[model samples]
Target: MLRALIYCLAPPPPTVNLVSNKSNVVRGKTVPNGTVSIKINAKVYMGRSDAKGLFNIKITTLAAGTRLYVTVTDKYGYTSKERVVIVVDRIPPAPPTVDSITSKSKVITGKAEANATVIAYVGSQKIGSAKADKYGKYTIKITPKKSGTSIKVVAVDGSGNQSVGKIVKVRP
Candidate 1:
């Protein structure tokens, strides 16, 4: 008499989760489509954002301290930006680092030689970018999708130097 033995092997499905800094109601409704892409170490994971800005992507394999990159695009203009240094481990990643910001009505004088670039961010989401001149002057016209939002700005030099500034509150 002869007997045979059988073995079973299969890979598990990936797991996904949504991440955000703050939760609030916009225009009398909740924003749910703020999801971002997550990467494990150096591998890209399949994920997507929901209508409420929530995302939960699963991976067949996962490792600790995986470096993650999150990016969201402006629905109107389709301009996209990626946040650097986003890490994913057993714990969630820290908030985005804000450098500097200024919100004055007389900052821009309708000049054409402005060379300075203004980068704006609300929490971890990048809202817009602007340019200034040699006099360290810039103007950014921001129309927030939601109410009661705040943003930060960073002044970057041509030599790759970043100067920290104050945070500005936005009113709808």
Candidate 2:
């Protein structure tokens, strides 16, 4: 007597579609049978597509002009592709320097990168702004709340890139 056996198996899943947006976000479409995983800097982030085959992946902001390696993999062990994205930033101006107080004056002067924009902030309020000269010199008139008032100054480049903030204390 001869015996016959029957076996059934499913075919491989569909390929994943991926796209990276300008705002540091990645979108993709995946198969319903599996979730999508993104790897960056040795860290793996996992997610799945919806019924409409849509997915959104959010990535952290990186330093200006930096690069991040990213890849996408589906549940069925299918990987779409590896992508390298450079962090896009305006590259803020250098920190500004507050000149020594030779006298008590409302005009605050500082040295910054040439052609930079200097903005003074007292707490959360913006006191004023000044444009740096060709020599990297900037001056802005700020109303002194009082002696010992803490102030923060930031420089902005023409491309809207902002520099690291510099802190200075007001003294009489």
lDDT of 1 by residue, 1-172 (tens): 1222111111111122322222111111112443344444566644345675455555443333333454443233232344433222332222223323334322212222235456667788876766666654556665533444566666554433344633555434
Model 1 per-residue lDDT at 5: 18
- How well is each residue in 1-172 modelled by candidate 2, as lDDT tens digits? 1222111122233333333223456565554534656665666666676776566767664455555544444454555444555555545668999874323657779899899899989899998999999999999986655767778889997768788888877777
lDDT of 2: 0.66
For every model shown, the clashing-pair count is: 22, 1
Clashing pairs in 2: 92-162
Model 1 regions more than 4 Å off: 1-114
Poorest 10 consecutive residues by lDDT, candidate 1: 22-31
